[model samples]
Target: MVVIAVFKSSRPEGKSAMKWFGAAQQRGTVMALTALQVVICTVWLTTASPTPYKNSQYITSKIVYECAIGSVAGFSMLLGYIGLLAAVSFLLAFLARNLPDNFNEAKF
Candidate 1:
């Protein structure tokens, strides 16, 4: 609506201004995904540390199993998050392909 309102007078400058603003604003496909993934994974990692079920007080087979299983579960969860993040990043980058060519373009 604001785009149309800005160009209500039908000036090419308004059109150009809108174009430049939109292009600049829409160019963050990878950055946004990466930032989101990092933040989520950081939170996940912080919350998941210490392995809730791990115990080294006893060296029995049951204790060993518990530690191994807990470690594996934590690692698996991290891997799942990584895979999901990768897929999301790929999809977002694909969607943003037509946003703007000025992304990472030469500054000089």
Candidate 2:
């Protein structure tokens, strides 16, 4: 009876751990993709305009446009990252709740 109880508890713990692992993997993928996107955007911006600004008004307008686009893209990426972090935190909490009582007692 004691063995059966322990086994039952471990099953839920294992499932919870798997869920957290999946969440972490998902976050990692998103992070990688976001980084790739930023890199691509940077490359595209650099390659798009090869000519130097000739007039003060043109330079100011160009700077404002580039800054606006960069800010928007950066904000969107940051929001996605924050969302991923929140999901990971929630998953971790769920996993902690289902973890075995002795989980912290074991050494790595």
Best candidate (score: TM-score): 2
Which tens-of-lDDT digit does each residue in 1-108 have in candidate 2?
222334445665644444434556768877986787677556646645233434546565554322334345555655676677779767766655654566557677
Q: Per-prediction RMSD in angstroms?
A: 9.7, 9.4
Strongest candidate by lDDT: 1
Would you list the C-alpha lDDT of every candidate in the order shown? 0.56, 0.55
lDDT of 2 at 44: 48
- Cα displacement (angstroms), candidate 2, residue 30, comes to 11
TM-score (C-alpha) between model 2 and the true structure? 0.34
Kindly list the per-residue Cα lDDT of model 1 for residues 15-90, writing each as its tens digit.
5555434544555645775676677556656666544365656865555434333345656666787898778668
Candidate 2 weakest ten by summed lDDT: 62-71
- Per-residue error (Å), model 2, residue 33: 7.8
TM-score for every candidate vs. truth?
Answer: 0.32, 0.34
Count of backbone collisions in candidate 1? 0
